[model samples]
Target: MSLGSRSSRRHHRALQHRAIALVVLASVLVACVFHNGASNGSPGSIPSDLEPGDVVHPSPIPGSTDQTIELARTKIKHIVFVIKENRTFDTLFGRFPGADGVTQGTTCDGKTVPLLRAPDRVGDQLHSFFDGITDINGGKMDCFAQGGYVQYLPQDIPHYWAYARRYTLADRFFSSIYGPTGIEHLWTFASQSDHFIDHERPGQFGSASREFCDDPLETALAFRSMARQEQERIYQAEDEGAQGLAQIRASLTSRWPCFDVKVLPDLLQQRGISWKDYRGENPFVQPLRMVRHVRFSSMYRNVVDVSEFMRDVKARKLPAVSWLTPSFKLSDHPPTSICAGENWFVTEMNGLMRSPYWSSTAVILTWDDFGGFYDHVPPPHVDLYGLGPRVPAIVISPWARSGFIDHDTMEFASVLRFIETIFDLPPLTSRDANTNDMLNAFDFTGRPRPPLLMRPRTCPAR
Candidate 1:
């Protein structure tokens, strides 16, 4: 009885052991598949050593890897992209007495031409509305002139030449795509109109039309994909490293999440890349609100309060990329007045450039979109955003040639491309991928651009 009972018990124990072994084997197989895919830089399920947003890829843009590594190495960082709200070229710089478009007339192929047309003589409807001479929209002053010989900068304005001289003004710059503040802001980053839904319907124009024009026309998206792949490759290395680490850790304390987590804060500390999404003060008119894709995702950091910027500045912490959007008071949405915005911006930038951070940084000053101000030069016909109207653009870098004017037509993608060139990072998606680069403004081979700092600016009151 003892021998028979003992044998039966041993058989039962053996079956249970086999079942446990099978379960462990299945788990290992699944983990291996995940690790392999993550190593290949596949999206969705990321690896242990990578951040959720991190992209892992094998081969990266040829120069991108080295550049990123170089950035990781230095405090002598590259771009400080400062983007402001809209103002048309004609409205802002055309009256600069020195602007060829203003005095000598913009020329092409040996012929002189006007850079922009004045708004159609403010239609009776608009002038009447603005003057409060007529009752419209319940006397709230719906003063916008949808048609007119728009107002031009008064010829007597001062400092127009100084602003141009101190900055790399792009007289022919164009908003990459059309529509309102939201769609154009996306162009600043992704350069893809993926969020746009409307295609060829004619009536939808401006911001509404653009928000609906979803298409990826930039190269940055491709790079993002590639960067993701490279990140995967790095994780593959890290995974291999983690396995070695885990085996070591397992031999000591019980395995916990802390030992396995690849924290972004830690990674950023190691890499020396600092990032923050500054939304300035106001939400109602903040460019971020207009970004359709952002609303659909948690991509944008909602509160980029001015207090944060002030705190960072006080701490003397100028990050590699300082993206600041002015608060509602600062954003150039109409009825708020344009002069106040320009004055505030010029003051803010002037102060920053004067700070110690100016030595190694290239501060980029640009308008987010043309504020529906009339620009004389028509944009080039491109199938991408489908010929958006012309907008003024300016690039002010410590490395930029002073008093320079670039007549080349530029788009928002051009800004990203400039960032890519200066920082040696790869481009993002869509039009940004194929768009013009801002390299023409600076000769990096030379001295950090000669100091061309100018006084705070203010556009004329409307």
Candidate 2:
């Protein structure tokens, strides 16, 4: 070819290269904007106004790094968070002395009804976000008549009551959200649910299927919209009642259950801290399975069966952070025998107490939701999502204050705060960032107390 023809081809190539460079620059600029906008106050960055259903990014609290580093040097090296299924604080400990519990409940129509004896296997009750709102009844707390007003006697849950007598019992702890199991589980790990409020829709995979991201069926989960929440506030201001709630519910949007949000494991992995999630039999209860990163990455290996927890404890191989969920039979969900649940809990405690990890481990025993049970105390409103009904929280650790009745207001985020503080990890969201770290429940300065192992009681014949 002639020199003139070669020069023409070279010019064309140069122009193509210039066009590609412009496109690359534009992509980089867009990415930077998205990162800065979505970062939840990352170091040296201001937080943007959070959108509804947006995944919260990490935010490091100024002046907290030093404090948390000192805490990580403490005797507690393991945190065993044992999460049980639904049962309200009042339902289990209402009549216990000195607790903020009531034996009677007021109906929506203004009649007072004494709490009935809850059966060993209570019937299932509706406890959706809507049900919680209706039961709260604009803070009057008298709408539980629509749900069930039942309480467990001391004889029924003697071991739990005994535990309260021996260890710190938090009377004011609430669920993270006003929804059911799946969302609450999400809060347990991430302190936020990516704005999803309820569980996956039933019947698509099966009524029992709680699988979110990893399910082959690819089910959609309902999430609240910030626009709808603002509208709800307006409706409340206008004194619109049931109709407004219905409108809000009708306006809800849905997305595939899978999410890309940051969770505690992300921080743990980054810091080289070991952790494990010992999941129960029911697939619906596993929260990490719904997180796309954990489910699909090498981190998935850390998700093990419930039995592995006991085995690990016996082998003295407990991780720095452990989450233990119960099987459906031992979940204490309504229609399941509470006796069996209690027995299972006691057995786990016994195993831990006998193991060497007990001294270094702080076990936080808590229920997931209220299960539509009557709780006289109205949950303090925190945000658009919740501070749902009160649930029982027992802090069982060698360093936990003995016989202490802690009334400090806390929720699932409080537990996250405790873990974050102990591990010197940054807060994943504003919820955990603002909540107290539960230092009030423990006395790390004093000598560690001896374990009080109790015998498993027999279930009464029904």
Candidate 3:
């Protein structure tokens, strides 16, 4: 052989070896990206936790500790709770397909009011305790007719309806408490209030219902107490001297010696799981911050600006649990634009959908209260506090059932139950202890569903 031929052959052999090494390295890189992430190794065994492999119940009933434990410790690494403002089930979702909606509306005077499209804004309907008593009219279920009867068609909340139709819908979901945002928010957090609540103006509390509206001075600045004060004023101003002040006042007066209690996030930390609450100028997390233990513990550190949540999501620094609350303009509270609210939610979910972390996340979208509209199904009497009027809830997860309408009767605390079941955390209160935790909404044993990626219909003109 010639020297030139020998040198050319040697060079070709070395190039082939380098190309083979590159191929092997590329294969390993692909495996590493997915290997560290979560998914069921097999299709048949996915637990309701959005992981394939276990066929446990998704939202286990209260006291079913084993099933909850199995579902909680799954591939779902993060749970995001997004709270919107006042709205009723019938008014918002009465016409939702395959769900429990108004079959008939019988007025107190033996008349029938059709469930029709609500205006761009149907002012507050009576949703106070006295309103419930009056609306119930001794179980007649007529207060809805007199207060304000309006329903939103699909066109009204397109993005929300689209999201519900594609994701899981809990048709029988209700607010934890009746009436306005103040006490209801407390119910949302701890499932009960720590302060003695009196809906009516207390003689000692002063006729001004707005007196204690601030977050006890200490937590005020930490949680933006000024916003809380303003929101409290609105809730009180809306209900003051209205149709049901007597009942609201009576309850407030009765609920004294408000007992501070442990909440769900506290339990998560005890188990070393990560969690956070992105509370902008919103007041929902304010009551939670007032909880003595929650305030004193590291849980206080979990509350950050909403911008941080987005940053963490993009950076994959998301905690195991998250609470996202948009401020008033973005909230669907009365006079505020629902379009803005829808846009905010769509932007948030889309961000999650776009992120790699979406495969292992669950986002819950729900309104805080009925906002004084009308719902026909007389709320099932749970306790003195209440399982108030039915409100809409959407469970968004890769494991959530497609086009499924969960008829299981549930309240705000049910969110707590689901969190406890998945993370193996302790139940915060009796309200969540016996309630259903959205068991039928998810089937973790199946292949994870693709993310629902759609822009909001209400997005402003580009």
Candidate 4:
């Protein structure tokens, strides 16, 4: 071969070796990135103290050797919270003459009285329909009495006691506010009871003594507070325009950090977590759904579209937490009719829980307010503030002890606190910052929980 031809062949071989080396190096770098990301947790997974597959034994809280995560630890990955409409604990569970008797009561002299004995007007049309009767003050029969009635209202009676008795109940659950749906709903999720107070009056958000009404004025005031006080100044830019309506628009706009993302991004972003706002029909702006939708993270018009949710769960694509609001027609709120809204909600949840994903899912059922329903117990007073009215709250999970009853007084912040505890995320300001953590529900001791209650369908009493 000629000398020049030999040199050309050597140069070609060198180029070929360089190309091969580059390909191998790129492959190794890609593998390292993928492994590291997986070890930390893929996007939207619950932020846990331990990595995947790492066994976490019970770890006790500092200064208290007996208090450990194991004491209440149960395998719960997805925490689904469904907050329903108004109704008090006594209004729903008061009539049942069984274990639910825990909810029976009458307000007398700053005390609560249980209606153990049947009323004298037994067999009355309304009397026979319900297990309990409301006795008017002095047993009067006036429909509009001032001091409050001792008798029961048929609509307010929670007739699902027989079925619900099988599941756990939180008797001490209280509304964050006492008045209309909006204020209570706001507190239900945000734990902000003072935001709706008539700015004209100090220390009184709204009056629970009167029927519910929403003035555009009130909405404007509330939005203003959110703008000025939200942790992120994104809600408060005067640059959006106008003092009233324009300001409200700007607040809702994505300019505000809170409104920037479909779900809370600042806290979850660090973990590659993202949330989808599936609220349909724009429930927040709709007059009918505003109160309820504002309290939830997702507001879908068709709740029965379980397939959409099912797909995520089956694919293990479920976010660490999902907030679902019932369709307007499905919610038990007035104007919307479900014979047993609570039962319907539970039935829907049970379906999700029954899926193979049950091992890692938890569902919390609660009410937005006591709706005009009667509640016998006087809510506890804390620093001169009563935590609204008594309402029902249930926690369901494969890790929950079946038939467990939690009597501790709780607020919406308890739910937030639980989520924070689960993910070890920082608490959002407002009510969540000062709330008690619901760590008592899990069993960190390493024992598995009994199966959750699963009724096939909604059952209504004849």
Which structure among the candidates has the greatest TM-score? Answer: 2
Winner on lDDT between 2 and 4 is 2
Q: Give a tens-digit lDDT track for model 2, residues 213-284.
A: 756565545645556446445234212223346665664676778887889999999999999999879766
Candidate 4's residue-wise lDDT over 373-456, tens digit each? 455554432211124456777776666655666554566666765765666666554345444455554444554554445453
Candidate 1 has its poorest 10 consecutive residues by lDDT at 127-136
Hey, what RMSD does candidate 2 come out at?
21.0
Q: Is candidate 2 or candidate 3 better by lDDT?
A: 2
State each model's CA lDDT, in order.
0.45, 0.76, 0.63, 0.43
| Residue 434 lDDT, candidate 2, scale 0-100 | 63
Model 4 residue runs over 4 Å out of place are: 1-67, 70-74, 95-167, 197-266, 274-307, 335-340, 382-386, 444-447, 450-462
lDDT for model 4, on a 0 to 1 scale?
0.43
How many clashing residue pairs are found in candidate 1? Answer: 45
Q: Of 1 and 3, which scores higher on TM-score?
A: 3
Cα misplacement distance, residue 118 of candidate 4 (Å): 15
lDDT of 1: 0.45
Against the true structure, candidate 2 reaches a TM-score of: 0.83
TM-score for each model: 0.55, 0.83, 0.73, 0.55
Highest lDDT model number: 2
lDDT of 1 by residue, 361-450 (tens): 666666765554444444432321322444555566666667787654457766665555544454444344444555566544456665
**Order of the predicted models by lDDT, top scorer first:** 2, 3, 1, 4
